[model samples]
Target: DIVKANSREPISNEGDIYALIACCETGAERLSGMMEEFGIDHLDDLADYIIDTSYRGTIEAIAELPKGTWRNVLKVDGYEQEIDLHAALTIAEDRVALDFTGTSGLSNKGINVPLNYATAYSVFALRCIIGPDIPNNAGSLAPFHVTGPKNCILNAQPPAPVAMRHTLGQMTPDLVYGCLSQALPDRVPAEGASCMYDLPLRHTPEAVSRGDEQFALELVFSGGTGARPGLDGLSATAFPSGVWGSQVETTEAVAPVLITRRELRPDSGGPGRTRGGLGQVIEMRSSDNADFMLFLSVERVLNPANGRFGGQAAAPGRIRISRDGPDLPGKGEVRVKAGETLIFETPGGGGFGPPRERDPDDIRRDLDEGLISRQAAHDIYGLEP
Candidate 1:
């Protein structure tokens, strides 16, 4: 029965099996070679030693947070109705556990996140907060356990329309960190634009059939990262994932789009002692006289990145057709007419500390660099006129 079920399993593409097998074989050869280079007789013993060392470090880091239970709940802008994501974290002397027993049920859309994906991000968040530089091997991961109900959004069952799993999966770090912020007050950074602002574009079938160039591609963009306890947030950065934003030159070389303008938005970052990172403004139109489609699924449009401690929330994102066109929804597909331009203003990160405590020099630097306007620097940062 098991063999039959495995054989009957659904696959997106037949090439996937070949790719997985190839990767597996390559990894095995590499691992064996590495073991030989280490002069290890048995792999089990070596694994044990590595795990033990990492475990010890994990225990030490876990000790920093006082033993206690911290809980956090936030709402997701689901397609139909609001979805809830609840985290109940329990930290003991030597270990930590996160439970998602109260997360919303599965969604009809493609945002459902499988357990493994959710677990991967959840563990990643804990590792980032607990020991960012520690080896993410089996030993290091042994100290943490994450759980969710079978049908919860974080643990979707099969056939749950999870093609866009990362849409929700990427938000785990922020969700998990919310609980940790309680235990380690000033340690964790504030909420950030967790998910990348991605634009998946493709030419219309008619355009492809004509003499126009045929192209289908994706361009990923980043927003500001949340400010840390003592440091200002980074501008135009992808937090948690740390993936690079797409370069304009690279996109122009392949995709059929003409970029009109791309720059950092002034005062987009929230104001605080250590200001949040600044988001960016991107404007583009179809290069050819052909209409194109853009499919977007991202956050930080309706709900801006929230600040930590006494900080302020960062700016929310916006998507729309040029000047007079109606504002586009955060999720869904939209068409860009041949001569029409599309504008996307990505969200900024939440600030750290109070706005009144910001340094005058930092505010001045932002103004000189055009990261923030002089008016905003004076108004928001309480700078002298």
Candidate 2:
């Protein structure tokens, strides 16, 4: 009966092949239906045409820029000290190359980036600056070439721990934008809180007694985006990572954590003609009387986001316990006692233009909306509250 249902099933085979045949038949039918619906007679010809068009568009995009080498150096808060991320972008008539020849050496921590991951972000950055409308594929990506020194932070060798690669990998867009900003001043935006603030929390043995089931939780949070040429940046928005913020209810339901407050921080955005996005303040505490482990791997602490075109740099990020204890480093694993509150203030984005060029009405609106404090309005924006 099974063989009869699948008409193309091999009669000589003793094993039941109905499921396998059905899957293959369904895939083949879908492909054939698509071809027929689109009236595709020559698949090879259509593929070739697509490749040729994409390649031409990519080349034309590169041809728009003047041939020159632009360089930028970015500093990241490493485990012990600051680490530098250097890039030299060379633009030619047909292609562009980014060489990470002078970046810092490999770290003894897990924050190192693999070459493939670095290249992916580098290509993404270039695409954001040039030919963003072009479809991303092999042909469209052919114009970009990225290389880095083998033992550097951007290209770690084997046997090196890279569990937290995205901590530094996501910074490539901001690093590359530093160079592109010099090439096309009007097109690029200022720096932003490029890295994500991810917290991985696991329950302790004591918490399992009060809970239904022991669970692991991951909470993702973003800082701010860089201000653009024509508009103010979005507050508490994800930049290059494109990740969504977690909901308070969703987090509370799965874990024994209480979210006390989550709101935008006042005076966190850099003031300029187009102001940068605002960072946020999040406060939480343990709901149950049980301690837990907190894994913190975040960035934009020591080195805040940089500004462009005579603008001011944004405020750096900070993490603390109850706002009274000592500030914690950007990356580490620590234990939190039960009922102890944790506070995280993310970094703000960099402004686009000079503060003097900012409109007075916008500054007034910022004061009215409580986005900026009265003191900051007077000190930074040169306005009276």
Candidate 3:
């Protein structure tokens, strides 16, 4: 029902149905195999023990946190406008609550987030901070509660065009983390390029008329993670999502597009004591001068990830046509004409501390590996070659 309503294509749901059946069939086999290997019919007693232990551990961790209220706001580039997401968090002795009271109203665009989806991301971020080693079962998750206004972006009503909820949904971690950063300044990492850059590409109708093959391909990738208190951020890594990106080989094999370049952009990571992760630069074009269409929505173009503890903000993202062509907006469907290449530069994560505090050895290493330019080292890091 959801697939048909949003995509207006009933055929797409076949893949989901197949996966659902596959999981159910394979899941039973895996469970039986596990029981046979352990010489037990079920792990019910063990599950209870683990959940109890995890619950106690979670309680202890929550007790350690400073009890107070913290508020933070984040703005995202919606389809045609920017929308704010506000969060007020309160950590009590036994529980934690995140309230999205002042967040923007529902966007007619596909970016609205359902209440349940918003709660999932908000609580996940909290769990990562408290009881990170815990198994994160129902017991560990029981202490956190999330709520928002019914019409807010984070809790939109029906018919609000939530087909693209992930664009904003993926950002919930950052919004909640922003509040936590104020509570535990040293524990949290700086903001990062949080959303996945997934491009749904297809041959345009004109291309099909001109003999181009009909194909639809999805290429997903992500930017860097924020720099941690004691460590530099990861480059071209998927932070919040933890897993993203479709293989270049797979896309090339299934589609008529040539990926010309995929490399880390130097100096894209914010300069600081613990440098943020780097973003990627990708260049691609339709094969044999055939026109194509690309659908994408990404963040950090208008407002890059902000730094924590005096760290610097990351470089903004960019998407444009190659060969001195015009820049394109970050959202919506874009047409790619013949003789033009799509150049996309994902934004990096924010730095963690003051740039001067960075290790000189790390600076030398960055220069040796082409992570940062010599000029950036001299100017931004205040170091000479």
The alpha-carbon deviation from the true structure for residue 28 of candidate 1, after best TM-score superposition, in angstroms, is 11
Q: How much lDDT does candidate 3 score?
A: 0.85
Clashing pairs in 3: none
Better of 2 and 3 by TM-score: 3
Q: Write the per-residue lDDT of candidate 1 for residues 1-385, one digit (tens) a residue.
A: 0011213433233576789999999999998898899887677876788889998988888887789999998666666667789999999988899999899999898989998998898889888879877899988999899999998999999878898888788888889988999988778888888877888887776764575665667677889988998899999998777877888886786667889899998888888888889999999998877799899888878788888887899998889999778777778888889899999999898888888888899888888898888787777778997
Clashing residue pairs, backbone N/CA/C < 3 A, model 1: none
Query: Candidate 1: which stretches are off by over 4 Å?
Result: 1-42, 208-211
Candidate 3 positional error at 266, Å: 0.7
lDDT of 3 by residue, 190-295 (tens): 9889888777887787654565577776677678888999998998888677765666776676677888899998988888899999999999988767788999
Candidate 2, residues 1-385, lDDT tens digits: the string is 1122113343323443677788899999998898999998657877878878888998999999878999999998987678999999999999999999999998899999999999998889889878888888888898899999898999999999999999999999999999988999998888899899787877666654665345576787789888888888788988888888877887886677888999998877877888888899999888876777788988999999988897778888999988799999888887888889889899989988988788989988988888888887788878864
Off by over 4 Å in 2: 1-34, 205-213
**Where does candidate 2 clash, by residue pair?**
none
Better of 1 and 3 by TM-score: 3
